[model samples]
Target: MLLTSRSLSRLGHWAAGLLTGLVAMAAHSAPLVMAIGDSTLFAPLQLAAQEGFFAAEGLEVQVIGCINGRRCLKHLTDGEAQVATVADTPMVFALHAGHRFDIIATFGSSSRDTALVARTDRGIAKPADLAGKRIGVVRGTSAHYFTNVFLLVNGVPRDSVNLVFIDPIRGAEPLLRGEVDAAGLYRPTGPQALEQLGAKGVQLPTLRPYTVMVNLVAQPGLSQDTLLRLLKAAQRGVALLNGQPGRAHELLGARWKLDARHAAAQLDGYEFRLSLDQTLLSTLEAESRWAVREGLVESRAVPDYLELMRVEPLRALDPRAMTIVK
Candidate 1:
């Protein structure tokens, strides 16, 4: 959680100092970032703030939690935030719309980040059971891609099912009320669905090749110095998470509104290794193709994602983990 014991004093101090007009956020704070709100995809970045990882790097990050990637992108585009956190799927779509930015780091995964949940009584015991059924998802987003990919990988033709576009927040509600046969939901909404349906809810298997890549994006011309400091802090955050799973799980439970056991269980579903690897490249490429094919973008051409990746920060932080893309 970003409000952990180690982080309270700094945040509280900032809050308390606001009345004096001393919180010159733009002048005093290190660059600001708008991260997806309460989204599991950006946990590493949140952990970086909560565990004093950013402070250890001599950087003061004023983090704003936006509700989703689209909003985060807005913050970056409008110059309200120096950096933004979003998944690769939306990143590709935004790029197609001419959002000039560079990917600084890739973190998190979709191993269990997205799930195809079915109401047990719907008789969706197998992947093929979804044919001709209604599957709800928030259209043109990661959940949308997950829904199609889930069906395609499972040999359930995309056209065989009815895809109803619904907001992810209440996406599961329809399923619980027997409004939709199934839904493509992501945490923490997936857990909400499971809680509502109990034994009646089943999460479909995650498609490894289709895992979503969470990334940090910065508006053009961000300083190399600033980028490196932020990444060094993030790198430490990853180490802390790996070194202290017990404490990490406790934090996750608080942030995600899950029990300790549930938090631990959810922890296994993601890999928080921040890097700009072939995995990220391939995922972006695939998502671009899907976005274009689905008419989600105005341009049919998929930009060279490599050019969008800025590797200097990661290379400086750990050259051993950096690989030449071309």
Candidate 2:
């Protein structure tokens, strides 16, 4: 049917309005690149992405997987990712390197996450046995910090053992190839390494030396509104993790192809919660000192960790989550 000029004009306006709405939606959903470590420690973030929590928060998140937390933070520094999942150790190193970012929230933590998997054949039956032997560790990571603390706790001097810096992506390959007697690894890697070693490997019996704080870091200028939305989404993910742990594990195992037993063990070791607490400050301070003392980072005064944290976002999301005194 032929349309009147007035009708045609109305139709044009409707079409224009429809196009405008579509453009606004597209802009709103522009994907935010989140560089995340491929480890069980980041279960909350991973779950949030996989379970539609991010989308539910009206945030389009595109995750870039890195081999370790250090690399994940590196992506943030290099501008490849707007946000990253990193542990306290990497944050300390990144601070030392003058890379500025804000710790938005700590989503997970575990004392038993990092361990030394020693080859029985290398006479490394106990933690002390690591003395004078080669130990493989991922440099500039929680595994690296854990290795030092583990040795010190076991009465092994840092200089006594030969530290073989291995690639984070390689896990325990150096140990598997007999290049190192033991490998300091984080979960999934630690379990996989022990499994691969069969009866030939043993994890040293040492008290938990380090509690890695798995954190979400934002680029320096990330808006508080965006941060709050991200944290809110992660809070929902944390609720899923804590409330229905079995379902969370099932989802994680399916998405990451984790062994059922390994997934359960990994999940059990972690406590997923959203917080910006004093413990996080204490851990960052301790890690900073350790990094400098161990010559891991160049000698420099520790940056004010409180300054590095952006607590307002978490506070705005949930006041209880912001326990950081400052």
Candidate 3:
């Protein structure tokens, strides 16, 4: 049927009103998240914001920098940030301290991300040689835990070594200057230190059980809608990272001042990812035990990990992708 002028005008008004409503929904529904992720090599949350992944998912994510998981947790607890990317070790401490958070997603299991780097010239040709040597480590971070576990597994006594607590970012210098016999460091700085140390540097083995899984967490009271948006954005961000690593690396280098090639190398070792499952919860429970023994936490009872995980957001997207919440 042919439309008359009056009907056509009515049709235009309806179209305009519908367009206005859609815009309003996108505006009001989009959650403004003050999200902090890895400050160094790890870059999922940063990539999402840079690549427009968050915007595509209708989320307004503000990326901030924190030195490590513990600092990220501090940002969340201090109300400086709404969401954060933290690892299991510090989370063990935070939880034991009575901070309530809902871990919405897990990033990945990475081995090259953290390690114990030693200077061969310090007469430390082996992990056991680390005994009586001064070691630079950042306390309450993954490297700190890795250092302790590495020493334990390698049969080095804690009392035999002198632990010098220093920031990971500043670790490479001290090792090069012979200020510390070795340094416990993670990617970027870790790799860079080894490169600078050349044949003089040695990478000791890492404890697989300590599986430092970087996770996205938020206050327990975070709205389900916002959590879902974060999940959507994170999934897309991981896809892009894997699908076109060159472009991702270039962007990361230009924006974050990281070397593209080094970033690519770093990315290979990490699983820029998303998950809320039994595998992750099981890991946390195991870490809790280790944490308590290491004096990282005082809780004799492992907080029921399931209570801290909010799986509905991830489940809503892909039930098969997430484990059944018990």
Candidate 4:
């Protein structure tokens, strides 16, 4: 049927409105680049990207996986990614190095993730046996800090053992090749090393002094709306992790090519959620002081960590999750 002039005008108006809406959506749908670490500690980031959570939130996210948090944060600092996944150690070291950035939120944390793995045949059946042994560590990362704290808590002096610097992604290699008697490792690497070593590899006992905080950091000057979208997507990823454990395990296992049992074991021990809290600030300050005392950084005084984080985005998302004072 031929349309009347009046109906044709109405159809034209409807088509114009549709075109305007599509243009606005296209403008806001710019691809967001996130440089994420390979550890399960940053599982939320991976889940968000892989499970279509970010896409569901009208975001096109590109994930660039790094060997460790330090390199992930480097991708952000070098202008490669708008967002990065990192732990407390790299942020402290970066701040001391004069690089400005913002911590949007901490997505996960765990006390049991970082541990010392040793070859039992090497007579290292216990933490005290670590003395004078060449210990492999990823220098300047959370594993390095945990190695020191593990030693101190086990009554071994810091300088007593030799620390063999190892690559972050290949943290367990030195111990696997017998280059170092023990290695302080985090997830994926830790579990993988133990599995490869079978009964010969043992995780030494410790007080578990440090809890690695997996954080989402943003490059300075990112728009708040974009940051909020990223956090919201991450929050959904955390929900999938907590709400659907079996699916999360399966998906993560498939992503990393681990068997179901290995994936479940590796993914255990973490509390995945989005928050900006006092404990994070305290952890940063402690790491900062440790860095200074160890001569890792030139700055003697601890920088005010509050300046390094922007809690408004997280607060806007969930007021209850914003527990950090000021």
Best by lDDT: 4
34-54: candidate 1 lDDT, tens digit per residue: 454457767777788787787
Query: How many Å off is the CA of 65 in candidate 2?
Result: 1.5
Which candidate wins on TM-score? 2
| Clash count (model 2, backbone only) | 0
Tens digit of lDDT per residue, candidate 2, span 12-71? 999999999999898667788999787888888888888888889988889998888899
In order, the Cα lDDT scores of the candidates are: 0.77, 0.87, 0.77, 0.88
Pairs in clash, predicted candidate 4: none
Error of 2 at 312 (Å): 0.5
Stretches of candidate 2 exceeding 4 Å from the true structure = 1-29, 259-261
> How much lDDT does candidate 3 score?
0.77
Worst 10 residues of 2 by lDDT: 259-268
lDDT of 2: 0.87
Better of 1 and 2 by lDDT: 2
Against the hidden true structure, what lDDT does model 1 obtain?
0.77
Clashes of 4: 0
Candidate 2 local lDDT, residue 214: 93
lDDT of 3 by residue, 165-243 (tens): 8865565898888889999887667888999999999987644434578888888777798888888887777777778
Say which prediction, candidate 1 or candidate 2, comes out ahead on TM-score. Answer: 2
Which residues of candidate 3, in runs, are more than 4 Å off? 1-31, 38-41, 168-171, 206-210
For residues 14-89, write the lDDT of model 4, one tens digit per residue.
Answer: 9999999999788567688899888888888888888898888877888899989999999998988989999989
Q: All predictions: root-mean-square deviation over Cα?
A: 10.8, 5.8, 8.4, 7.1
Which 10 consecutive positions of candidate 4 have the poorest summed lDDT? 165-174
